[model samples]
Target chain A: MKSLQELEEIRNKTRESVYLRKDRAGIRVVVGMATCGIAAGARPVLLAFLEEIKKRNIKNVTVTQTGCIGVCRLEPMVEVYLPNQEKVTYVNMTPDKVSKIVSDHIVNGQPVMKYTIGVDGR
Target chain B: MEDLSLHILDIVQNSISAMAETIRIAVMEDDTNDRLTVLVEDNGRGMTEETVKKALDPFYTTRTSRRVGLGLSLLGAAAEFCGGSLIINSQPGKGTSIEVWFPMSNIDRPPLGNMTDTIITLIVCNPDIDFIYEHSTPGGKFVFDTRLVRREVQDIPLGEPDILEWIRSYLSEGLNEIRGGA
Candidate 1:
């Protein structure tokens, strides 16, 4: 458990040191975390990003959660936020996929074409 | 439910709702034996053997909101996946006890996450349900009890924003004392 103060410090550090996006910048990974998402196993997907970011020591990216992304069928969904690019939604992600996304896309600047929503053949 | 710690927290939440005034939670890291164990004991409304058996099933739920309940099932799965087991013991009208064990070295087992958050969430949401959480390692221990706090406030609700934050910070500090990080 992190104290509110510690969390605040983390937030402050993120704001001061990390690039502050004007609601439309930075590389963001938003995982769904509402009840449906939890039921469908979203926590691990979210954790994968956190763990990867910490392990790889990537400082520019921020991971967050949103409720009920209106994709119940794709409950464990995540949307990648790349500046000036479409918010690419990915579905049915396991924690492993999150790792792959981090390594291949966020770190290497090569979006995983196979896992993206557009490439899902939906 | 996917988060193993969340499932553990959910089970304790039910015990709180079942009229438990005093609940004790223990997290022990038996590094000597290379195991991690979680125990939740509640002096609440215990259920019959049949209900206890049913509770493990994904379909058994007291609420009518949905057809399935996966909290217990998920916990069971998590324990087994970690090369351990989950145990439930209850005596009707007496109390209930739950234990989940995990292998410390299991690769697939998820991190415990911030149990400080779990305890804070339980305390904040269930203002009346008292909690006594204890975590111990080979080196030390950390304990918290809301009733002790209530002894001074004389029944101040734990749900109050300020108090809730205090409890959370207290957990963070205590956990840090026990472990190097909280």
Candidate 2:
């Protein structure tokens, strides 16, 4: 039975041992998770980002969620922000698309234009 | 909502938008009573009596950008279809509590979906808010609180990849053990 206390202990110990680098000035991946997004199946999309990050052992990238972006019709949206760069908003995101975003955008510094709002004509 | 967890995510958004500082979500499955109950309580800006009355109405909404707020209404319809009821208790300054109960074996009752993602996503999205989630079955119980993690890792973000992954596995493992893999 891993209690909350035990989990905290694990976090504390790992925090010291891992020694995370200070250069997280990396990309930020934000998923829309408002009522509209949730209704459109954003949970799996968010989980997919986390899963891909762990699977690839990627570092410096953070996955987060936000409320409605005011475009409910183009929901399940994701926005990636790199330091000192314009935000690339991806609409109608899915679990499979998350991997490509991670590898092509986060790792290679190129956004997948097809899934983005700029090309979607929304 | 397709599942109880999705409904929970939707309901919690209301609380978050209300600027809730502490939110508690409880899920209880009682075999003896043949009921599955979900309670989401939050110390947020509670709605007025009139607003609460209209919350279950599909046409009513607070947002100006949208014409409808269907989250609560959908959950209410789902509960009613499963021979269950949904209740809301609130005060303007106090807090809000929503209790939903459904028949455990009802054909219309939706299965509880991926709760692990629900919790992790909530925490990751709203890093400042504190969440307490409890799941209780006839066999055992599991409790997760953000205060504990925050205390230990004071500076680190909960959205950190390693920490979020740990939290996810911990929730799934705890639920699996308590439910004895169903």
Candidate 3:
């Protein structure tokens, strides 16, 4: 079983970096987590984002969840909001697509145009 | 949803939307009694009697964005299908408590899949809220309360990647041990 001591060690190591990044206007990644979203496997997609972000050590991105985006057909939807850019909504998200989104859009600042709802026509 | 944990994830989202400050999730399994129970209690804005009735109806919902509120209804169905029951108790300004029980041996009862993901997802996404998760099996019991972690971490957010990773491992290991090890 894991202990509180390990958690304390993690806190000690990461506190300074977290404090430093607190003041910046970071990017936000929001996953739709409503009934439709969960039924369509949004949990895995959300987990994928968190894993990818953590594995890549991306500090300035905050991954969160939202309620329905009103597109039930496109259930597992994701919306990315950069610091000063328009929000990009991605439809039909899957765990398989997380890495590219993280690498191209989050890291390289280049949105994958083909995956956006705009290109997918809703 | 595919499993009970997904149902839990869905129900907790409703609590989050209701602005719950604290959410308690408990899973109890008794092999001798052949019973499994899942309880979720939240300090959120409680629903009225009329609203509670409507909440059980699949087509009724409070949100304009969608006409269907299937979270509770689906869970109720899942419980009923497994020779179980789902009970909801609430008051206007107090809170809401949802309890679900299932026959442990029922073949139709979905597996309690990936609670670690459900918990970690909730914790990291809603960093400000406190979550208490308790799981008990024939072997042992394990409890995780974010309040204690919050006190220990002080200024560090629960959503910090390192903290989240630590939480994931803790839950995975703790849950496995309660189930009599991997």
Candidate 4:
């Protein structure tokens, strides 16, 4: 049986630092995870992105899940928000596509144009 | 949802969206009693009475883009189909707790899928929230609380690859040990 005493101790100590880190600007990768998104395989897609980030040792980029992006038709949508840059929405994401996005956009700082909603038009 | 874990994942999203700080998920499997119960309780913004009533209605939803809230409805239907029931308890600003019961021997009852993956994904994706997962069977019980893990890591984020992988194995091994499996 584990205890919470240690958890509370660390939470108190790291609370200030975690709060401070929130203010630091960085890239954000948000995945839509509403019912529609999940049904369309967003779970695996989201997992893939997280796995890729960790595999590549990508830093300063936060990956999170959102309820929905409003385009259920283009589910498994992933949005990338770069600091001081426009938000790019990628639709119909697959794990393979996520890998490409990680390499082309997240790693190399070049948005994968073909995968973007603007170009895919799906 | 294909399995109970997927349903757990889906319903937990509601708690996350409600801004819950602490979420507790409990799974009780009692083969002798032929009952399996899953309880997901969250300390988040609770819903109003009307919202609670409408929650099980597939046509009712708070989202603007879509009109269907199938998460609860589907779970409710599944519970009923399995000779069980689903209950939602909520009070405004207090929090919401959903209790679902299913017959252990019911053929229609969904399998308790890969809970290790579900818990790991939830913790890794929502690092800020504290999760307490309790699995109880006639043999024994296993409880995993992220608050303790947070203390262990202190500065390291829970979402970190090493931490996530460690948590995954911890959960799988812990469950197996409690279930008396090698």
Candidate 2 chain B weakest lDDT stretch, 10 residues: B153-162
Interface RMSD for each of the candidates: 10.3, 2.7, 1.0, 4.8
Query: Chain B of model 3: TM-score?
Result: 0.97
Q: Give the top-scoring candidate (lDDT).
A: 3
lDDT by residue (B51-115, candidate 4, tens digit) is 99999999998778777888889899999997999999999899999999999999999999888
For candidate 3, the TM-score is: 0.97
lDDT per residue, candidate 1, B26-98, as tens digits? 8998888878899999999998999899988888877665666666777888889779988899998899998
Q: Residue B179 in candidate 3 has what lDDT? A: 80
DockQ: which is higher, 1 or 2?
Answer: 2
What lDDT tens digits, residue by residue, belong to model 1 across residues A1-122?
A: 53344434333444433323334346888876544666687666765676677677665675666655776676688888877777878887788888889988887777888887677636
Model 2, range B1-182, lDDT digits (tens) per residue? 67999999999988988889999999999999999999999999998999999999989988887778888899989999879999999999878999999999999899999888799989888888999999999889989888888887677777767677668777898899789886
Model 1 lDDT, residue A52, Cα: 75
DockQ of prediction 2: 0.50
lDDT by residue for model 3 over A39-68, one digit each (tens)? 999999999999899899898999998988
TM-score of each: 0.60, 0.91, 0.97, 0.86
lDDT for position B133 in model 3: 99
For all candidates in order, the CA lDDT equals 0.72, 0.86, 0.90, 0.86
| RMSD for each of the candidates | 9.9, 2.3, 1.2, 3.6
Residue B16 of model 3 has an lDDT of 86
lDDT for each residue of candidate 4 in A1-122, tens digit (9 for 90 to 100): 33345444545665665566677787899988777787787778878888888788766678888887888889889999988779999998898898889998887889999988998855
